[model samples]
Target: MAQQALPVLQPHPSCTACDLATWPGLESPGLPTRVWDGGHTEPQPKKALLLVGSHPGVEENVKGSAFVGVTGQFPNRLYIKGGNLADFADVYLTNAVRCSPRTSELVTPKAVAACREWLDQDVRVLAQCYDEVVILATGENAISSVLQRKESLRTFHQGQVADVGGVECSVFATYLAAILLPSNDPSKILAIREHLLLVWRYLKFGYLPTTVKVPPPSELVGSRVLDPSPTTKLISLDVETYGAFERNHRGRLLPRQTVFHPAKSLHWDGVQRCDLVQTCALSWRSPRGGKLRTKVYRLDRRAECDRLVSVLQRLRQCCVLGQNVPFDVLYLRAFNHRFRRVLARPHCVLYELQVLNFLQNDQRAERSLKNLSLVLGVADYRDEAVDLKKGQRYRDSSDPRAWTYNAKDAQATLLDYEFLVEAISLWYGGDTDKWSSYSRQWYNEVLWLTVQMSENGVHYDVEQLGRVHDRHQVALDWLRDRAKRLWDWPMSGKGSGKARERIIADMIQQYQPEDLGLARQYSRRVKKSRLTGKVSAGKENVWLLMGVVPSRTPDRGKLLAYRRFQRLRKVVESYTGPLLHQVSEEKKTPNQQTALVKGVAHPSWHSVPSYASDEERSFGGTSQCRITPRNPGLQTEPPKIEACRRSRFPSGALVLADESQSEIRVATGLFGDEVFIQRETAVLG
Candidate 1:
C-alpha cells in the first residue's frame, strides 16, 4: 500500500514583515515551515481557530505538520473522540510563537512578543473567513501570550469564557500532554484529557453543555428602553439603604447607634423607621423587543415617595419586577403604607429565575442582579468609580456614582427579566405552557405567602422565655462544675480569668482515649493524603469522642459529663440567650395579650422547626412538659440542639396540612399504574 501524501508547508505572505530568517535562535535549520491543514484545498467556510503554544516536536518539524508528536497526539485523539470536530482538517491550528525553542529553554516573552505580529495577522485573516472564531488557548503561557490575561493560570476555571481580540472564546488553563507524560498518576492524565474534550466542545459550540448560553452580544440593548404595550408592562425597581436596622432577635433596634433624620413632620408616626432613603424605578411597556421608551423615577424626598407610590400603584396593573422583591416590598412598606400597598402583587424576577433554574436543575444560577446581568449578556456597571464595600449612603453622598449604580441596577434587573422570559419561553414552548405557568404561579404564591406570614409573626411569651433562659443558665453552671470534677479539668481563677478558661478548652480539645489509658481498646484509624501522599489521623478527632466510647467503658461517665457540658454551653449561647433577647415587648394589640418573636423576616415561619426530646434531639435536657402530642417538637430548634421551647399560637389554633404522598401519587398517575396505586392506598389505609 502507498503511504498517504502529506500537505506541503508554506509561509504566510505577511510573515516577511517580521524578517523570521534573521531572528536569533529562530533560524530555519530544523524549524518546520508554517503548516496548517488547508481543508478541501478549496475555499470552504472557516469555523474556528485551534490556537496552541508553539511548534511540534523534532519528528513533527521534519514532517512539517503540527501535533505529529506524542505531545500533540493526546489532543488530536480527544478532538476526534469528542465528536465536535472530526479531524485536523476541520480547524486551522497555529501558535503564539511559531518556532520551537533550542535546548530545553522554552520561548521567552520577548520572542513571543516579536512573533505576535504574525499571530495577530493570522487571527485577523481567520476571523474574516469564519463567521464566529473561537480560540482555544491550551496552556498558561499560551493564555497569557495570546489572550493577554494578567491573572495566573491557577485562578482560571475550566471552560472559562473570555474575549480574545474581537471574538469571544473559552479558555482551558491546564498542563499540556508534554508535561503530563512523565507523571506517575493516572488521574492527572485523565484530567487533562477531559479538559481537552471540554475545549473541543467550547470551540465547536459557543458554550459548554453544562452551562446555559447567554444571548448573543447583538441582541443586548446598550440603553434602557421601554416598549409600550396595552395589556402588559415591565417595571424594574431598586432601593438603596443606609443599613439594615430591623429589630434584633431580642426585639430591640439593631445597630443601636443608628440615628434617624430630625424630620418629625414626615409620615412615619405609627410605622417602624427604616434605612430606606432612595428608591429608583424604571418602567417599560412590554413584549420587550425593538426600541423602548422608558420612564425613570428617582425618589428621595418625603413628598417624592408619594409620587413613587402613585407610580407603583399604576404599575400594579402591569408586571412590576425587581431583584429580591420581598425585601424591597418590606422596606417600601416601612417608607410609606401606600408604597407597600401598591407593590403588593409585583412580580419578583429573582424568584422567577430561581424557579426556572430549579426546574432546569441548573444549580449554578445566581439570584443577584449583578451576576444575572453578566450571565445573561448585559454589561454590568456596578464596579466602576464607586466602592460599594465602603457602604456609601445615597442620602448623604453627593457623588453621581451612587445614583448611577442604583439606576444601572434597575436597568440590569429589567434586562435580566426580559432575557429570562425569552430563554424560558424557548425552553418550554410558550408562556401559557403547563410547566412555565406552574413554575411562575408556584413562586408567586410562595412570595405572597411569605409576606403575609412575616406581617403576622408568631406569638411568643416573654415571661416563659425568661424562665427557660434562667433554667438553662442554672443547668449550664451545674454541667460545667460536674464535668470539671469528673474529668479533672478545673477552671482557672488566675488574672484575667479568660486565660484559665482557654487552658481548660485546650485540655478538652487535646483529650484522646489513649490519654485516659484506653488506647488498647479504642485504636485510632489512619487516613492517606491525596496530594502529599502522607498518612494521618482518620478517626481520633476529639469531637468524635462520644462515638468512640465503648459500651462497657470505665470512662463512659466522664465522657458523658463532658458531652453534657458542651451541649449546655451551645444551648445557652446559641438559643436561650438569643431567644430571650429577641422577644419584642411591643404588644400586637391592646385587647390581645400577644408579643412577637423577631426571627429572620424573608422566609417568615418557613424556617421554624418542630421540637423534640433531649435523646431524640442533640440538646441536653429532656422536656418535662409536653405542649402537644400531634406536633411533638417545636419547629426551628437548632438542628440537633433540643433546647427548643414551646410557644403558644396567638390564635390558639395550630393546624398543619401537607400534600399526602404527592410524589407517589404523581408517579402512579403519570404511569397509569392502577395496581401500584391500589397497593399504596391499601398500605396507607
Candidate 2:
C-alpha cells in the first residue's frame, strides 16, 4: 500500500491543552508523557482502514505508539482470528483521547471534548484519501466521540453508518479491548466475534441496511382486511393484548375498572377473562416484488374477532410465523374459542422464531425479538424511531401507536424468519428444504406436546395438601416453643448465623469440666475461626454437633427440635405456601371426559434444550432437555422427610417406581457398551 507521512497531524510531545494533562499520574517523574500522536500511518497511508480505541493505556503511553501494549494487541488478534480483515497492522490506529488519563475515570466528557480537535483533524485528513472512510470504533468513548452522540452507545446502532467530520463512513461500534481479555465473560467474547463477522458481511455486500420504513398500517375502517393474497405462502402474525390488570411498581396486580365488576368478588376466573386481544397485525411478502406488506385490524368488536379467527382458519395451507407463536396462539384462543379448531388442524404450520433462535445459538445470547433483529442486522424500527416511552404499555396507548407497534412487530418477525431460515439452511449443508422439514418435526413432536402439558397441568389433591400443611404448622409451633425454652434464642425472629454460633459457644463453655470427654467431643464437632476464635454455625457444623450432643441433655433435645423446625419450615414455605397460591381461583366445574380436571393448578412448562444442566438433565426428561414447570417449580420438590407428604392422582390412585443406576444404563446404551448391556440382560433373564 502506498502511504504518505502527515507529521503535522501529530500533537506536540509535551502539549498540555486538556485538563487530563494536569492529572497527577501524567506528571510522575521518569514516566515520559506525550500528547499521544495517535495512529497516524508513518506517511499517512491513502486507502487504508482506521481502527479507533478509547484512549492510550499505560503500555501505549510508555511505548509512544497506538496498539503497542497488551490492550492494543487485543484488537489485532480479534480482527485476524475473526477473519474479518486480513491484517490489523494494515489499518491505521488512533484514540479518541490523544493524552492518556490517569485512569478511565478521568476520560470524562470534558476530556473527550478537549481531545476532539486533533481527533477531528485526523478523520478529515483520512477522508481525503478515500471517498468514504471505514472506521471501527472499539469502545463507548470512541463511539461517542466519532458519532458525536452522548455518553452512552445505543447497542442496536453499532453497525450503523454515520457522517463524521463531514465525511460519510461506516463506523462499526463494538466491544472494548478489555472485553477481549481471557478473564472476561466467554459470552462477551463470543458476541464480539459475531459482531466482527457481521461487520465483514456488511462491508462485503457494499450496501448499508438502514432502518426499515413501513407505511401506516391500512385501517379496517368498518370493512375487513383479513383477506390474504392468493399467491402468498407465508404470513407473519402478531397480536397486541389489553391486560385487565395493571402491575404497580412493586409488581402487585391492580384490576382496571373497565374489565373488573365492582359487585363481584375478585377471583381467578375473572382475572383470566380480563386479558383480551386488542388488535392483530399480519405481514406477508408482496407477490409482485417480494416486499413485506403489513395490515392491522382492531378486534374490539365481536364481529371483528370472529373475522380474525375465520381468516386464520382459511390459512391452513399457509405457514404462520411469529416471535413466540404459542403465546400468540393461546391469546387468540382466549379471544375466540373457535381458534382451537384452526390450530388443531394437522396441516397447519406455525414457525416460532423464539424457539428457533434458542436452538441455533447458546442460551447466553439475547433471544428477544428486538435484540435478535438488531444482532442479525435487521432494521430496528423501535425506540427513537417509534416515539415510545419507557415503562409505557403499548396496548394501553392510542390506536395509531398501538397499531403501528403491532405492524412493525409483524414486519420484523418476517424479516427475522427470512434471516434465520437462510442461516439455518447454511448450517444444514445448504439444504433449506431439509431445515424446514426438521423444524416442522421439532414443532410437532416437541413444542406442541409441551404446550399441551402446560395448558392441562397436574391435578393436585387439595384436601390432602391442606391436612399436611396443618399438621406441619402445629409441629413447627411446638418445636419453636421448645427451642426458645432450652436456649435463649428468640422464637419469633430469624436468628443470624453469628447468633447461633454465639449460643453454641456459650453452651460449650458451660459444659461440666468433669465431663471432659463430652467437652472434647463437642469441641471437635465445631471449628473456630483463627482470626476471631468464634465457632462457625454452618449446616455442616450443626450436623456434627448433633452427632456429639448427649441424647438426653437439653442441648441435644433443643438441637433435635431446631432440626425438625427447619424441615417443617421448608415444607411450609416451598410447597404448601406457593402451592396454596397456585391453586385455581375458580371452583371446580363439572368433569368432562375430554377435559383436564378443572380448578387445579396449571403451571407453565418450558423445554430449554440449550440451558439444561447435567443435574437438571438427570431427571428432567427422557430426551435430556429440561422440561420444567414454572410458577411453583414442582420439579424442585423438597426431600421426603421434609415434605412428609404424598401426592396422589386426582382419582386417589398411588404408584411408585424407580430405575436403579438409570444414568449408567443410559450412558452404556449411548456409548455402545455391549459388555455391560449383555451383563444386565443376563441378570434380567
TM-scores of the candidates in the order shown = 0.50, 0.60
Compare the candidates by TM-score and give the number of the best one.
2
TM-score of 2: 0.60
Worst 10 residues of 1 by lDDT: 608-617
Candidate 2 — what's its lDDT? Answer: 0.59
lDDT of 2 by residue, 1-685 (tens): 2344432345445656667676665532122212122333343323445667778778766666666687777776665335445322225667777777665655666666666666667668766554446777776678767877753332335455677777677766666777656675334565567667656665555453644566654552235443566567888988766542243223545343321111111233343342455677888887789876777766756666676667777776788888877667666665656877777646567777866675555422445676667677775543443343333454342346666777878888888888777766676567555355775767755556765655455566566667777887788778767666767665335554567778666655655346779767666656665223466554566677676577898778767766776678777656665566432112233212111223355555555443311100111222344466654556656544224333435345435434456677788889989999998788678
Per-model C-alpha RMSD:
15.8, 11.8
Residue pairs clashing in model 2 are: 4-43, 4-44, 5-43
lDDT scores in order: 0.45, 0.59
Clashes of each: 16, 3
Candidate 1 TM-score versus the reference: 0.50
Worst 10 residues of 2 by lDDT: 612-621
